[model samples]
Target: MESHLLEVLVCPLCKSKLDHNREQQQLVCKADQLAFPIRDGIPLMLQSEAISLSSSET
Candidate 1:
């Protein structure tokens, strides 16, 4: 993902900043415990498209 894009992207739920997980290719919202997938360099920010994050994830 581009750094510029990541800087502007936020969680759709909490509107908090997202963390980039390069290996996983997803944007993570720690506050909301959700991971928005980045497919083909595009972020899917919808709640229904997000993956529930386990407490173990950070």
Candidate 2:
């Protein structure tokens, strides 16, 4: 994801800032315990597309 884009992207549910996980290719919303997928550098910000984060992952 582009730096500018990442700066503007937030969790659809909580509207909190997302942390970029480059290794996992995801944009994680810590507050919501969700991890939005990034496919080919494009973030899927939709709530339906977000995966729930496990305790260990957080």
Q: TM-score: which candidate is best?
A: 1
lDDT tens digits, residue span 1-58, model 1: 9899988988899999999999998999999999999999899999999999999987
Candidate 2 stretches with Cα past 4 Å from truth are none
lDDT for each candidate structure: 0.93, 0.91
- In candidate 2, clashing pairs total 0
lDDT tens per residue, model 2, 1-58: 7899989998988899999999999999999899999998789988889999987896
TM-scores for the candidates: 0.95, 0.92
lDDT of 1 at 39: 97
